[model samples]
Target: MPVSHPDPIWVTDNDTLATYCTQWLKLDAIALDTEFIRTDTFYPKPGLIQLGTGQEVFLLDPLKIDNWQPFAQLLGSEQVVKVLHACSEDIEVFHILSGNKPAAIFDTQLAASYAGLGHSLGYQNLLKTLLGVDLPKDATRSDWLQRPLTDIQVSYATLDVVHLLEVYQLLQQRLKPMPHWNWLLEDCSNLSNGDLYPKPEEQWKEVKRAWQLRPRQLCVLKVLAEYREREARRSNVPRNRVIPRGSLWPLARYMPDNIHSLSAIQDMRHSNIRHYGEEVLSLIEMARELPGEQHPKPLPAPLPKAAKEHGQRLKRYTSQKAEELNLPVELLMLGKILTPMLRSRLEYGLFKLPEQLQGWRRTVFAEPMVEQLNQPEQ
Candidate 1:
């Protein structure tokens, strides 16, 4: 059954937004969603922000309104539970807008992962699975930053929050008795902390093929990635527009020493070479002279065949644990991190478990995992 949606109140001014904020303070919870564009920019350009408080749905235009302090205050307050669906980018929009994140959020997507619905469930799918309402997603790729949003665009935005209220109620009821409820909240709080957003200095950890570089090359890659991050933010352009990943791989692998060498890189755009060639050469040269302690440790080789087989056993154990708890197997043991954990044992002769295997997992699954890995191959 489709729920009735209130005609959305168009919020074009701060005064209207302030009034809504006041009304919001009287409520115990609200659902939020944002529409933004970031095709050519490092940060999301928030196009429209939508909110639902059971009785009303409203659209606030980010292009016209400058003040979000009142809304920010309400979001940062413990007085209300902010509800969202797949809120990682929405959190970024707010963080960039108000310099603070929302308090006590419930992400429907994350909740579904723990609800045995499926991992990373889509919004419309969740609504259908829970409420039997299937909403059309016509504006999935619309350019929201444009002026004069069509009726379809506005309707799409409204649907984003219309069902969130009921979804939260249902998920809460389902989670009421589960011990992993705290785990869900913990994950949501971490998303709101903006900890997932890495600093420019730490960008190298996410670079593709990072482990391919030796220590000296690793130092160069780090500096180069950091430089790209800084420049992308400063210029407010896409990171690839600054320097492509294809360019970085060769430059790091060869450890180029001069502007000529940097220029000769196959994928370095002529524009990038013209602008940043000398600086690139200088960064690589400086990295060559850095102290050993400053360089990163080289990544060890992949695990051997026997250890790879043992990883399959560990995977089975993780799946059984997840099944017992009604959690997604991915939540308990991420295969990406698991690969490295198995390789870590191969190289270090002991477990160097991933972060997921620590914390709550240590008590729940890691102890058994350690025992399993320690036993000799059968």
Candidate 2:
């Protein structure tokens, strides 16, 4: 059976939004979400900001209303918990609009994972799981930037937050008694604390097949990637739009010396060559001039045959521990985190807890994991 929902209150002007924000400040929690477009830009183009305080839903038009100070306060207030689901991109929207992400957040997708309901549940699936509500999917990709949004678009946006408050309430109840309750809060707090802009120098680590490069080649890649990162932000364009990833590795590998050499690399666009050819060559020259000792250590190779057996042991131990705790293995210890730890162990001959595993995971799994590795094979 279909359920009826109230029409979302549309707040387009400054005063109306400020008045409602004052009212929202009195609430214990609010459900929040955003609709944005990011097809070609470095930053997301925010179209709509949704807020539900249980009594009413408000759709704040990003195209209108300049006053975000009151709402920014509401978002940052430690008194009110801002509930969201899968909110990484939404955090970017909030930061761009209001100048800060929520100071306090209860991410339902993360909460559900901790509550043992499921991992990475979509908003629609979560609503179905908790409230038996099936949302229409037709208007999901609608042109939100267009004015006079269709009635279908409005309802779809309204339905998004209507059930979210209820979901937060239920998840909170489930989490209240768990031993890892504080761990969840700590993790949620980090969502807002994370730096919005990553360091440009470290961007080289993200290039495809980066580990294949020699140390000096890595130094060149690092310099070029840093330039790309800075230029992408400066021009407000995608990184690839600044320079494609495919072209970057070859530039480092060949150590292209001039515009002619730079242009010869596969996937190197002519516009990039024309626009940035001189600057790119200068950065490569800087890398070449750096002393051998200044170059980064060579990227670690694949695990040796001996380390492969140890990695399997670590994997089996982590799986068994996750099962015992009734925690999702992916949540408890992701492969990204595990691989680095294994690499450090292979190099140092001792298990090293990664910085990511420093919190509750260190408390729960660190000792046991080390013990499992230290024990002789049966």
Candidate 3:
């Protein structure tokens, strides 16, 4: 039988939030979710937060509450597990609000993947699959920041956590008996503990066509990307607002030295040219003057056609193993981890295990993956 959930309590002031948080601190686990807008800012603009204690759902208005110390302490309490679905963005909102990441977290999406439910399953689908509940989708893009939320929007937000608590309970029953139960917790911990903010120094690697640039050219792109990242954060604007990413590659390749040359680059906005053209030229000049040793190491080129067979073989073996284990292939052998391993073997002629593959994966597939890599091409 489906459980009848109570109406969500609206939390508009600090005292109510603190009082409920105190009671919630005593619970073993709680369901959590956040509603935020991120169309134009480097940081998400939090609008509402929803929490479920298995008994009642609470809707917290970020615009109304001031003190979050009590909730911060609850989030930091290692004894209590915070349950969320697809928690990456929610983690960011929590950190921004409380200055603390949940000490313990269980992400239902990841949990479902581990349980062989599906990879990257949407919350609505997961609910329909596990609990036979259908959620309304009308309020997904509604303005959550606006005051006097519509009744439909409020119901949608409340159901986000209300059904989540049920999902958590169902997944717990399915996963607790499995050997990989702790693995789900481990991955969730890594997700929450990860640095949500982008690092300026490493930002260049994300630019499209960045690998085409030579070492010295890469240095110029690196500095330009760093400047854009820093300026975006400082001004609370999106990265492209500072300088369009499409312009970075051309600026690096052409080594633009003046406003005219900089302006000629593709996607270079007039505002960017007028504001940052001088600094861009100066950065490029400084990069050119840098000694050879200071240049960034060259990015790896694409593998030749003949070498691709090795990655294909590794993928085949990994997919078979994932099937045997009743898990998603992506959960077992992510391309980000596999591609770097293949590149290392090609360059150094020896397989080096990446740190990401060192945990439960090491126990499961590490030896076989290395052996597969060492196999000679047919």
Candidate 4:
């Protein structure tokens, strides 16, 4: 059983935060989580920051505080280890809100996977598995921006971080006996670097199958995607609001030249066309006129037989190894990570391991994978 503390100090102002910082500095590791709404806005509006230090939980109200210097310093502090569960988005929030990423981070979800718990385990399932406590799901959809949050909401939010400290401690203990602790540390260190925040525009090409389009379609998509990215930021609304994902296929396929043609496209509705029609048409025109060499050629699809064989082999190998280790197959290798590696090896006749497959990963996870690949078929 875990101890429950409900006396969370709600720090709303600088004076209160300063007082809290005095206490916060004394802590070695703090569990952290954030509540935010991103439905209406392009970027998430952070409503609350929940923190715990093995003793108590605190909810820092972003709506009330004007200065977050103390909070930023705490995140950047070398001595404090900030713990979070599946913290990619939370890290993004910290970067956007505090303009600094934490110096030390321990992501419990990642640790759970490496420790053979499971890959991408839901927080609720993880809590129950590790702590034997069932958390309430009622507040999952609550309006975090609403003032005077209910006791249930507060309790739910606080619980997110309160047990995180204990979970981290438990995972650390388990990982001490495993060789993958160093890999987890390296991954966590990379998460703390904040480099993922400012990705280059060309990187968007990797989204879905943007690379599969013809050169002309690729040109149009590149331009439209760039436009969408800029517009999403400028309008402070979600990218989907400006242009939905379904609309992209048509935009890339037709590469329409005028508003009339763009509006007539089946995927784009008249109302959306009327709203963003001219801009879309203009972008298409630009792509059509783009320099020939500048247009990206469609990447050739892999041979059907080889592609199918490699995928089956990789899946069988990973599944068997994961079963032997009592770990989830997905924990051993995510499809997103495996697809590219398998494709590269089959096509290029060179096996360049994914960055995630390197370092301690190669030792604990990749060695058996390589062996499985080399084994002759029965």
Instruction: Let me know the TM-score candidate 2 reaches against the reference structure.
Output: 0.94
For each candidate, what is the lDDT? 0.84, 0.86, 0.86, 0.78
Which ranges of candidate 1 are over 4 A from the true structure? 1-4, 194-196, 257-260, 291-293, 347-359, 372-378
- Which digits, one per residue and each the tens of the lDDT, describe model 2 over residues 107-126? 99999998888899888888
Query: Model 2 misses residue 213 by how many Å?
Result: 2.4
Shift in Å, residue 337, candidate 1: 4.0
Q: Which of the two, 1 or 2, has more lDDT?
A: 2
What's model 4's lDDT at 302? 42
lDDT of candidate 3 vs native?
A: 0.86
Each prediction's RMSD over C-alphas, in Å, is 2.3, 1.8, 2.0, 2.9
- Candidate 2 lDDT score at position 363: 77
Per-residue lDDT over 78-174 for candidate 1, one digit per residue giving the tens place of the 0 to 100 score:
8799999999899889888777799999999999998889999999899999999988899978999889999889999998898898899999999
Off by over 4 Å in 4: 1-4, 194-200, 207-212, 320-327, 354-357, 362-378
- For candidate 4, give the lDDT: 0.78
Model 4, 1-378: lDDT tens digits are 553556787878888987787788778899999999888887788888999988888899988987888888989888889999889888877877788788889999888987888787778888899989787777877799999999888888888887888899999999977656876788788788646434426634754666568888888887887777778788887677677767786788878777777766755777567778888887888788888898876765644576777777778777777777666676567565676767676866644466655554566667667665656658
